[model samples]
Target: MTNVSRWAAMLALLFATAAWGGLFHAGKLVLNNVDPFWFTVVRYTGASLLLCGILMLQGKVRWELLREHWRRLASLGLMGYGMFGILVFIGLSYSVPSHGAVIMATMPITTLLMRWVFERQRPQLWAWCVVALAIFGVSLVSGVWRSSTGAGHSTAFGDLIAFVGTVGWIMYTRGQASVSKLSVIEYTTFTAILALPGLFAFAVVATLLGYANRPDPADLIAAIPPILYIVVVGTVLAALAFNKGVRTLGAVHGIVFINLVPVSALLISAAKGSVPNGSEMIGTLLIIVALSIQARKMGLGAKAAK
Candidate 1:
């Protein structure tokens, strides 16, 4: 690839990862206004509806094409959005932001492993080492990174939940399996449409069980801006950018960018009045170094990352 295209691809991946970093904070913010399950319902439904509008503009939506891919779409949607969404928000509710952020950085490693196991596509040994370096840095940022799911022990339990969600996320990544015949927008939108009922069902159950409050207009209005930011930037745009990067740079390069997510999330968290702990600062620098080395390996000058 030309340097300009390479740089743009890297930047897109970075932007996508950065957007994901912000979601922890945003999810916490939105949860204050809407309960966990309802937040999922509202968020995905709005995203799906917006995707419908986008599809309409793209021309007559090819409803039939989706039928051929329905099973794959349904499985990915449920695993990726529906189940993973619940785990992450609930995980964050139990853990501190740092725990969630640090745990998320491990996703690249998990994705890499899945790529190897499922696709039988092993990366270079040096690539594995570089990922390990990033993962070690993430563990430092994790600040007592046990993954026990004992609900009473909040941070550890949260780490465990986040870890489980990462596995579900791994399936989502690997189970894309073959080259998609669908365009990016078509793939993202239709899967989301299929995923809606489960989210609504959870919302209903949560409301009925008194675990969630009924969502009123005022509550939705309070959460609208952040919710919109999430559905647009965090979910849709990020997915597009992420897929672009993966296509451009291949999965190994694209996935390692995830190591930087905790640093981005930590910095964003600090902006929200959560001051950085010392380990976070050190871990951030280590991760940057790791990314810089990896970038150089990709023939992007280390200085270019500046």
Candidate 2:
């Protein structure tokens, strides 16, 4: 990539990471007043509708192509949107938002491992070390290594769930690699449509089971602003920007940039009075460094392969 092009790609990646980082704080803000499942239902439902409208406006709607990849699309939807979304919310409920963000810092490492294992394309030794460092860093960030018993057992459980969510996202990204032949809008729309019913079902179950508490009117009103931000900027705009960045930088390089998400979330959380202590900062730094190293290694490997 030329210097200018590379700089543009980096900027795009940074913006995309910031958008995703805001999701942790945004979701936390809404979760204070709304049920997690219901929040996802609303978020994904709105995103799906918005994408559908865009497709219609562009005259690019293709019902037949959706039918052709129905199974893969549904799997992606269920795992990526439905299961991953709901589980992360649950994990957040049990853990700190900053901790969840830090855990997510491991996504690039997880994606690399999955690609290596499933695709049989081994990464460099440094890449493996980076993954190990990220995993350790996540444990520290989650307070799993602070206990006299060697990280409180409950923290371990929460970390495990958060890590699972990270794995789910990595799988989703890998799946996207195979389906990149489709336009981003088309792929996003299909995933959203397939996930819609499940999201609604999850919301319904939460409400019926009394898991959803009614929010105060003020709280509901407060949530509206963040909801709008999430729907418009976080989901729609970020998706578009990420697709453009990937086109310019390629997937491995584009994805490595997501390491910035934890940093953004940490800063946002600190501003919101959820500051992490020195240990947490150290852990976050370790994870970011690990992910960066792993990403660079992967990017180089891709270039060598090409």
Candidate 3:
């Protein structure tokens, strides 16, 4: 690929990251008006349809691949979409968002370990350094350096659940390593589609069990704008860009960009009238430097992989 194409792909991933960041606000809005489980069901359903439309437009839909790999695709859907969502949601109840946020900020390091255990790929000294800086940056941004009182919350349990959720996401990223026959679009769409039944089943069960805070139809209707933005921009667009970046940049390198999430969320939050702070600024710069190193090497790595 030309340098131009590489840059374009990087920008696309950045946009996808930004979309995900926007989801922080969007999710907050929807939670006020809809059941979290119900919201996730709608979000995934919409994402699947949006992806199907995109694949059709690009003439890149690969439904036959599903016939050959339904099991793996469904498993990926369970890892990437299911466990992360369910576990993280439950975890937030037991712990503060700060705790979950810190754990999530460690995604690159977690994914690095997944790469080692699953792919048997050992990262070099530089890779380790990058991940270390990334963790420090994420810690700073996520307020890991700040002290907190337990305030009667089970932060330990919550943090552990969040860690497990992080593992689920790491596995999802690892899914890309072996599924080379499918295009990024095909992989994202099929997995998302196949995962729907399971997600739907969970939502239905929760609703039937009279789960607390379940949203009514009117609440779902009221949350339309944020829901649409989340399903379309956050899930569909972000998934496409992220999968493409992973394909181009390699899983470990591309997954490192998740460090950018806190940065984008902070900036976007600031734009929506939240004040920015010094720690956030420093952390954002740290991520920028770390990702610059990663991207500089990504070009060489991609060329080598080819």
Report the lDDT tens digits of candidate 3 across residue range 64-155. 88999999999998788888866765555554433444456567767666668767998878878888886676556545565565433225
Highest TM-score: which candidate?
Answer: 2
* Residue ranges of candidate 2 with Cα displaced over 4 Å: 1-9, 148-155, 205-222
Candidate 3, superposed: residue stretches over 4 Å from native: 59-61, 89-105, 123-163, 205-213, 276-306
Candidate 1 residue pairs in backbone clash: none
What's the candidate order when arranged by decreasing lDDT?
A: 2, 1, 3
Once model 3 is optimally superposed onto the true structure by TM-score, how far is the C-alpha of residue 82 displaced, in angstroms?
Answer: 1.3
Question: Model 1 — TM-score against the truth?
Answer: 0.81
Q: Please report, as a residue range, the 10-residue window in candidate 3 with the lowest summed lDDT.
A: 146-155
The prediction achieving the highest lDDT against the true structure is 2
Poorest lDDT segment (10 consecutive residues) of candidate 2:
147-156
TM-score of each: 0.81, 0.86, 0.80
Query: Which residue pairs show backbone clashes in model 2?
Result: 144-151
**lDDT head-to-head 1 vs 2, winner:** 2
lDDT (0 to 1) per candidate: 0.75, 0.77, 0.73
